[model samples]
Target: MGDGATTTEAGPESAGVGAGLTRAHWWILLAAALGWMFDAMDQRLFILARSPAIRDLAAGADPSALPALAGWATALFIAGWATGGLVFGLIGDRYGRVRTMALTILMYSVFTGLSGLARSWPEFAAYRFLCGMGIGGEYAAGVALVAEAMPARFRPIALGMVQAASSIGAMLGSALSLLVGPQSRVGGWEGWRILFFFGVIPSVLLVLLRFRVPEPDRWLRARDEARRDPKPGRELGDVRAIFADPVLRRRSLIGMTLGMVGQIGLWSIGLYTPELVRDVVFREHRRELAVEADSLDDLARAWATETGGDADSKLSEWKAEADRHVGRGTLLQDVGSLLGAPFCTWIAIRFGRRKAFATAYAMSMASVWLVFGGMSRGVDALWMLPLLGFCTCGIFGVIVVYLPELYPTRLRTTGMGFCYNMARYLTAAAPVLLGRLAAGAGGYSRAAIIMSFIYVLGLAVVPFAHETRGEPLPD
Candidate 1:
């Protein structure tokens, strides 16, 4: 295991603890959370943009093959995420957290704009992969910075708020798509491309970060402490030290298991909500929807204007209505995510981490299966998607809070990145796995049902987890 927290790092001398996170610290939280929020917005942009982007890029591909192609893109994006997290985690621990956050945000923001310009599936996926790298790295840096900077008593709450703020980014993407996302490639303007272009806006964050946020004092002291008492085997950011030490190894494995449970359940089932709505829930209503064209929304009509002046066509109207249904469904699911993340944090605060996790896992299983197996139309999705989202994605709060508490100051970012990003390595294949399952077992709903059982694995793993509720983040 790693050694104790350096006195200079975790010692009461750490400022801002006096005022329950004083004004300066609130700025710290704001900067870190906004960085994470923009990152979440980029991620949501990709999820919402994936199918449409694939459709536009693969101009002549068979309609039946599009989903499979999109799965490949998701897989590559996730693989890049895992790789970037592992590398940048080490960089943060050894060099500094602030530097890592800056580099990652810039990397993703630039690549996100590039994603809007890709002409083929491989090109688009490559841009997304690079963007994923920046995003994956940001999580470890942001969470560790927040965990180390806040006083022990309020750290969990602060971290929970950061996670909750991500839901706002997601909601932004959902709402933006409904208002502005185009349904078809009209006069060379693709709806998905327009969205990716907007993602570049987050690049402006570096300006705020430049003058405001600082590296956590905890990270600084640990680096200095190691310099003064250089231990040969326990160097800062030592990836080998993480596993070579027994207690840290145990913690690493358990953390990876917990991460995998959520990542797979989310990437495999929960993240696919839009496709599920488009392919299953909204599939049977084409004729019914056609009859209601007179009842069509002005927002939907405005949304169709991206058709390069062909807004009055029956085809454009139908596409606009279809996309709107998917948008509302997505927005509801994200709303649940906004609330659910904080609910899990609150549970951990009151009952303890283990109980909160167990409850979330059990509910995730029930809600995902119920929604997947029973829901058949947009009406069913209104209530069901929110519940599914609440149960499935909320444990992200527990993860952001719990993992940082499991390691010492020296190994904190490296360990959190590994345990969290490592699961992503395994989860990288989930999109492909779901595609194959969907192909063989009828469709996405059935495939999602098979995947939902992974949450049951969370139930089994919960007993082995160490509860760190109310504890100071391990030094």
Candidate 2:
């Protein structure tokens, strides 16, 4: 192994007790978490609101075209997200992390709110894509801020906590859609407009960020060192510095692979659970509906009378039930986060980072297989849905904790941006794939089984990564 020396000189005060994180650390964590929470909330709201808005805009047009529009919008958003990660990751590395964080939050927030004003699908898609660029930048900046601020011993826990906070944001988004979505009167495209407006709430945090967060001391030191040295600034050499060594290269690769699989599985399995349930419900409803049909109106009237509810009421009731299902899934996901995050932190502290990752991956694989595979049939299978969420959430919660540990401070944001955002692009294809599989197989259970199998691939790669538990943050 290369002798890992501090890349920059530390102040005399920096040497003692590593100056165990003070109130400032907690304040930084709070600011980062809030920003991330809103970041996630806005992204998820777009997903939730998009379909309805597209359907409304396409009214008097072919219904089949809506899915295509959604796909196009999603593609545009992902492209923006990837671009943001690449551009802002460099910016964070070159500029101050605090400044970059502020810029990123403002960029995403303004566009996210602007998405509210979109009158057509093209306008909405454009706004969302712009908003995505901002959203994508937040992860790198926020992760860097929290990673740099916390004491090394507490970094894993801090990152885990921040990662878990996103779940809370996602759950809140779901709750808002359930609560405020139905009450909105903007029949065509207005429902989504209101939801987009709700995304503006996080922009308010920008004002507070100016007062609360500071530039990371590590970053400041690096800049000072760069200024003092004869080396030219804006050197392309720093880019190669990340991969010049074997250990760093290995860690970066491992981080990238883990991120790719984890992201694909998270979106494919986690976010799509509701769609899976809906497919099942629809199939069951269709079978029941097929039993009798006179005229379509007669069939509708008779079915409504027999069901003892109007279509809207029945839909509302189904929606309430779906909310309960999603609620359970969300709760389980949170519980997993609560358990796995601390556990991974503690394990990484005592055992090692690699072992901790392996253990988590093992549990994640088993949990996913059991929940998705085991639930392939029978009434008891329904219970597995929430259980799956619990297990996978724990797996995901381990990411923020572990990834930062793998890279030195200088390359941390770049490594993280590459791992996280690249995976997002790769995983973006999953929803379409899962939809195709569900369509071909005539059910979602098969699609879930396929998804669970991919987790095993992730498990196999765990052993290849270098162990970092109890190791000080690499220089």
Candidate 3:
């Protein structure tokens, strides 16, 4: 512990009042939740829109090269995420968390909308990368702010709620795709473009946040103490402070390792739900078409001749069905995520921190395997997608609740940001690996199953994580 080493143990007086969160706590939680929610929406929007954007941009290029281009674009976004997280994390420590958070929200919101104006693949990628940087910075600042501000007893719920709200943001993206996507064409703009434009909505929240939300008292106190110190490296929010001592360094590494497991499992495997849905639905459409065409050849020929149309009408119908299938799958996944986020809080509170993580890891592995391995039909996917979403994304709840508790106010954001974002360097390559593995005989399922093993690594590391339940935020 550094400057603010308040004992985590509950005193008799404090223990008696296990009532409810205060107004300030609710406000902090709401602000953090809204920011994180929009961040998630933008991320899912990019994932859903990437293919269409790439296809249009690569219009004259070889079709086979489009997948490679998508991979590169995804990698670029991850690069931006990693870079922004590291850089803004330091800024958060040096500056006030609320100020840094507002700036990050503005940064991501503007760039995300600008991504809509991209004319070519490179331009689109450039804008997305910039947007990713903004997205990356928001989490550290928001989580750190909420962790330090909320009442210690309510901290877990507040943090978990913030992470849970992201599922709604993701759902908003999916809903937009269904409503304004290329198929629907709201306002005559492409669905992807319209979705990107919606990114501007979050900037509105930024105004309210900056005007109303207060900086954590802990951060203010730490800054004041650092200002009074005359020694070298007495500066507030020093990123290096996390590694200056053995205990801090060990905690930092453990947090980072845990984050790495979640990132690889998520970015590589879970995020690919759209692609898998598309493939399964399209393949099913083709098979059904073949069977129908074979069974009703004479009747279909007569009907076609009478209607003055060819077999293309059936193809159009199949396309529509495939789209519907994918839309439904996405909706279910979001629903699962909604439920899972809250469930994480319950589990962590009922059990301890380590056990909660262990259970989540186990569930993640099992759900992912079942979704990708045994399922084939769109209907089957509709049921399985939510379970996958629940397990994969729900675990992030632990991050906001656990990481900040491990460090003191001085190094809190720095250590938390470092741990959360450092894994991006390795996980950035996940999309490329997924493409390669999908190209194999086993396809996306095999690749996803292989990737799910990343969760097992998380389970292995759970024992080493320091238990933080009922503990106060380290000064």
Query: Which portions of model 3 show Cα errors greater than 4 Å?
Result: 1-21, 182-188, 290-317
All models: lDDT?
0.81, 0.65, 0.77
Give per-residue lDDT, candidate 2, residue 248: 69
| Stretches > 4 Å off in candidate 1 | 1-19, 185-187, 286-313
Clashing residue pairs in candidate 2 are 353-469
Q: How many backbone clashes does candidate 3 have?
A: 1
User: Considering TM-score, which of the candidate structures 2 and 3 is the better prediction for this target?
Assistant: 3
RMSD (Cα, Å) of model 1: 5.7
Q: Over the stretch 137-241, how does candidate 3's per-residue lDDT look in tens digits?
A: 888888888878766666677788888889999988888777765333456666678778989999998777866777777887888888888466566667777
Models sorted by lDDT, best on top: 1, 3, 2
When summed lDDT is taken over every stretch of 10 residues in candidate 3, the lowest stretch is 4-13
Residue 244 lDDT in candidate 1: 91
Model 2 collision count: 1
Error of 3 at 355 (Å): 1.0
- Comparing 1 and 2 by lDDT, which wins? 1
**TM-score of each model, in listed order:** 0.90, 0.82, 0.90
Q: Write the per-residue lDDT of candidate 2 for residues 1-475, one digit (tens) a residue.
A: 0211112223321134234656667778898888888887886677666656666665665543544555566666766776677678778877867777788888888888888787777887788778888877888888887877677656666777787677677767766766655224455546567778888788777777777667777766666666677364223215465667777677777777887776666666655554454344444444667745322234446668777768665655554554445444444444444455566655655666666666666666676666555442223334665455556655556677777767766667777777777777776676667656765664556776677667777878888876655456654
